[model samples]
Target: MKLSTVFYFTILFIFISSASYSQAILQKNISLDVNRQRLENVLEILSNKGDFYFSYNSSIVKKDSLVSFRASNKTVKEILTELFNNTYEFRESGNYIIIRKAPIRMTLVTQKGITEEKIYSVSGFVYDEQSGAAISEASIYEKKMLASALTNEDGFFKIKLKSSKTSTAELTVSKEFYEDTTIKIQPRFDQQLSITMMPVEIPENNTVIKPEDYLAPDSLQVPTDTTEQQLPVSNDSIKVQQTGVGRFLLSGKQKVQSLNLKNFFTTRPFQISLVPGVSTHGQLNSQVINNFSLNIFGGYTAGTNGFEIGGLFNIDQKDVKYFQAAGLFNSVGGEVKGFQVAGINNLVQDNVYGFQAAGINNFVTGKMHGFQAAGIYNHVSDSVKGFQVAGIGNFSKEKASGVQIAGVSNISNREMNGVQIAGVVNYAKKLKGLQIGLINIADTSAGYSIGLINIIIKGYHKLSFSANEVENVNAAFKTGNSKLYSILRAGVNLSDSNKVYSFGYGLGSELSLNKKKTLSINPELSCQYLYLGSWDYLNLLNRFDLNFNIKLGKYISLFGGPSYSVYVTDQDVAFGGYRFPVPPSHYNTTKFSHKVTEIQP
Candidate 1:
């Protein structure tokens, strides 16, 4: 056959198959009236009305049992649901509706035991009821308290519980593809129990013509009901499981253990491990939550509830409570509640509720509610509510409500509500607090920035050209919030006899005097160096000015105010070898200062 012809035929086959499945008898709407009819007779009537056959094992349904119901234009599913009390499932095979019992839930197994002490300990082996074989990794838990245990390779498990008010507590055993079994036992003593779990059965074939023969003579068809149902993990959980320590440090067996117990957790008193796979709990290490864990080299487990100390590192599949310390690093997949200290690094994939200290770095992918201290870097992907201190840098992807201190830089991608103190640079998208650094920047700010250069992208900005007494032609640029700003200025004395060049930096603040913001008071302090043609001596000039600003237009202003000058210089010659003019020590100089300036910024 040609390729195109083959492709067309394949598409046609799929369409026909889908059509057959979509027209299955269970979905067809029907009107039925029956008053306490025998179950078998009702099935026959339904089969005839839907033009299909009912198939099942004779013992599966009580044929002689009386069922009474009336359905008006209801789907076969609805009718059958009322008949069987929703305890059966139906599947279509050709024209047959194959009936089977739904998987049983919470089968109770009760046993009487002698009560002895205040501590209750239970140990057991789980087995398959049909084959009389051991079932591994079956979860046995007390649902009310979330105390659980998992069967190991030998179908063995042990769990400890405290005495409760009731004489008996129920423990549920569950595994994939098996019926849930609940067992009731004395909660005040130690006992051993054996549990047998039944596997779910699919409805058997009972038709004259099999589905495989009807579809294709040579191929066998597997029923869709027999496929395993896999529980899905969330995207965030998957990201946490794919961390560097989870991938490289955990053994294949440990990973498998984590996957098997994704829906359950079991508590243990204590555990010891030489490495990830070799532990006191053997291959079931990652499935256990322990009170105390001592790792000779390192260890991987589900969680820590009390205290954990490792010689090298510790990797937890879930939350860590109390205290956890390691020689090299510590990685947790869930929340941290207490203190976590490490020699090198500490990584928490979720929130941190306590303190974290690391030699090199500390990272929290979720919110941080306490403190973090690191030698080099600290990062929190979410908001921070406490303090962060680092030798090099600290970063928060969201808002920071506390304090951030670093040697080099501090960054908050969102708002900074407290303070940021850094040696070099500090940045916040929106600043509602204070920032002290060499260079401070913000998109918009209602707070103060103390630095040599402060830039608020959406706040205050001004450029001015003015003629002052000492420097004839001067230009200055101001940037920051209206409350506080930094200025960079340069000037040149154009006079032939006393030619001088000056560059300076200053700090200023503006205060509005009226509702229209047309008039304002500006107080500025600046220092300048006069280059009088010689680099041989010091020439420093300091000035303080108070300027009264009046709005002239939308983008223009007029300003003239009194100024104070203080000069300290040792230079005797100007740049061209002209005698440099030195002002007296206690002199005050003032002249009319005018400019094409921007005001009310």
Candidate 2:
């Protein structure tokens, strides 16, 4: 077949698929069996059963909580109203349904010749371009107005605003991992727009494009391996039996093992009990460890090598390998080698080698080698070698490698060797990577710093004071170290009456003639503005100087050099007001006091 025919057939197939999806009617009854579960989960069940989709924010909707209810047969609208208790509002757009916060109640009084506030409702549905599935929790915001809304469980939104006479604004739709789209809205009246967004195509493996191949000429590009490998999102709990993800579970295993405290003796490879007190340790359970453990409420084991799950908390006295999950907290004394998920916090005294997720904090006193995400803070005393995300701050006392993303600050006391992104400040000593925040500081920077204030304490800085033939008592604040530096200088003719201001940038290098005597050479180019009332002119000077330093003490040095200067200025100083190598005949003994070759000594 021809390529044009293939393209036409593909378009037709997609259109038919989307049309059928939109035309799917909700005829099946929504059978509910919720048991105090989260509203988001309940909505998901309803959408799946009724052949629709739910769009909601993960932040606003909790999906992990258990719910309780049982209904054999019920309509979708009735079930949702009872589930939400009339708190959230719902809007329907074809097969999609939108959930939103209810607005304040208002009465409609439509009459002739009555100037009342005209309220207009903007409704729409956001969908995926390829799959045509509803994209839940997509941001729909006005570009020029302060009105915005998030699409509900079915990717539907209804934003009601007071109508204006010339109310035309730009509407922007954005979603995570998707390309953003924008449309103009002329909302003098009520309007509905169904927006389809294309997902962004990111290469799976690391791929890079050079800047010079994309940017303008006259600029050099230093290309590095910028394809950062992002770690996978940390799982909340360990998977069971390494099964395929996303399969619906009608019911899970519910087994209990509990015996009297006197029935057991030595440590067991696996222990299952109603609580930790009646485990294999019997009455002497304080020092016993287990390879695999499970507790209905909470557990206190000496150590764990395999998986362990608890309802409230899991306290391991020594070390914990493999997966360990708890409802409240998980604490380990020695080290954690695998994944650990907790509701409140995960604390390890020695080190953690795998992934860890916590509701509040993840603390490792020794070191951390893998991914970690916490609600408040992630603190590692020794070092961190992988990715870490924190709600508030990320602190590493020693060296840190890989990526760190924090809400407030990312601080490393010693060396840091990766990307650091934070809200306020990112500081490190001897940073060998990139730092992006409001303020970035490094003691010694061998990498890039991008922020408002990029302070490199040991990089390039100096101050020098010198005297030249044209200007006496010249003081310059030379920035950048001895190897390469720039200068901003000012001088005055204290011996005469010619006040001059010089400002310029310079490039220079410093080399060691020997270990005992350090010598430097500098080539400086400057523009000087000579002021003579309103009669002012400009001076451009190019000079190269070799400076030899003789150290007297740690804080003092003596330096001098031989200078070759080429002066160019639009001034009435030479013969015919413009001349190089001024005529010796034009010079009187008293008139030409400061000649061009006066520096020849």
Candidate 3:
């Protein structure tokens, strides 16, 4: 009887242990009511009940339609099984569960049904699981190895990697709009694989994130000094728990910088680079810096102290000193002291002192002190001190105090203090110097401009009609600023055909003599072709005059001038072709040969 009792107790103990293990393995109970909720939302609700996370294929799972579910103190397994039924498969991996479509595994049969361990090439094809359609541009990589490949347009791919002793590789497949699929028993044999991926169903409430989320600090931020005991570590450091820049909901530009980044980067004496990734900054050859540097392709670092050269490009984080030359591009962050030259572009962040030359473009954000020349365009934001030249265009935002020459156009935004010469057009908000171009435009002409069309907002424009001693009715149109003006005049007689029809153009200016009476002086020079008959006649008249003007009102002015004339003609005519000599008429014999016509009207 005692033996029987012991046996009974042992049986009871085993039964209780098994029961306890089942209870412990059971998932937590959850109670919630969801009304037409998305599958993603339902998964989220399930995850919140315990320490479980769900990963599923979005394309296979329908998340757009609302799902209605009501469960009270139900196990998670029961709830999920009821929701998906036979439509998907769930595999638990630690705290995570991967959800995917029904699996269709294909196996290879070796000769004599014998499998051997050996290294071999691997190839594969990726396709959509639901439709069996080929998926292109899908990335495939071994989880633990550096072997990677991408699917071609026909969904074919190949990769080379070491064969695993276990004859399996963890292959991870991912593509745009598709859920990631991993093959646990990855093929290491000389065989092909057919991978199927489902499209991801995006959830409305899910946080958006790119595939590659760069959460590391920006490269521009300067490192903090750990040597200082008084420095606050909390303020200087940045904590990014996520693997991305997750601030996508921002409506406007957000300036986010590490506390230490606002300060300047540590200074360096010199550095060298043979290419972009190979440089002294990355090599850590010296703790401080060098005074001289050289490069074969490109260089990028904090700053330069002496001279630097590159075959392709040169990039500086802050400042550069002495000289720098590059075959392609040169970029400076803060300031430059000496000279910089590049084959393509020379860009300065803040200011430049000496000189800069580029094959394409040169730009200075702050100020230009010396000379800047470029083949295409040259621009200065603040001011220019010396000479500026460009093949196409030159621009100064604030002021220009030197000389500017361009093949196309020259523009000054605020004010000008020197000279600007362009082949096409030139413009200044306010001119305090000289401008020469085909078209010169200014708002206020405090200096001078010479061109075919000179427009000044505050200077002279006049249309005058007057009678002169030589011509009965003469009309002149004048336009310009205070510094210079152009005059175009024409005259004709009413009754006589050969009374002389003249057309002329000249340059002159008005000088203020008295402020009270608005008196001024006008000096002009003109050359006119007198038309006696047609193109068969040859007559040229050059005149130089000095006139005094008196302004009576806003629109009316009186002016007269004494002119010295030189007339040349091939033939002697009535009143259009010839003029008498400069000798006294009393001693001249040809005085009787000339006739003068007087004004009739």
Candidate models: Cα lDDT each = 0.80, 0.63, 0.66
Extract clashing residue pairs from model 3: 36-67, 37-67, 58-199, 58-200, 58-201, 59-199, 59-200
Task: Give the best candidate by lDDT.
Answer: 1
Give the alpha carbon lDDT tens digit for every residue of 103-166 in model 3: 5443422221223555455677888875567877676665444345667889888866566667
Query: What TM-scores do the predictions have?
Result: 0.65, 0.36, 0.51
TM-score ranking from best candidate downward? 1, 3, 2
lDDT over C-alpha atoms for residue 307 of model 2: 85
Candidate 1 global lDDT:
0.80
Residue 597, model 3, lDDT: 19
Provide the lowest-lDDT 10-residue window in model 3: 249-258
Residue 553: error of model 3 in Å?
A: 1.0
Name model 2 segments beyond 4 Å from true: 1-266, 273-280, 462-601
Question: Once superposed on the true structure, which residue ranges of model 1 sit more than 4 Å away at CA?
Answer: 1-240, 577-579, 583-601
Question: For candidate 2, lDDT tens digit of each residue in 328-363?
Answer: 887776789989999988878788999999999988
* 1 or 3, greater by TM-score: 1
Least accurate stretch of 10 residues (summed lDDT) in model 1? 592-601
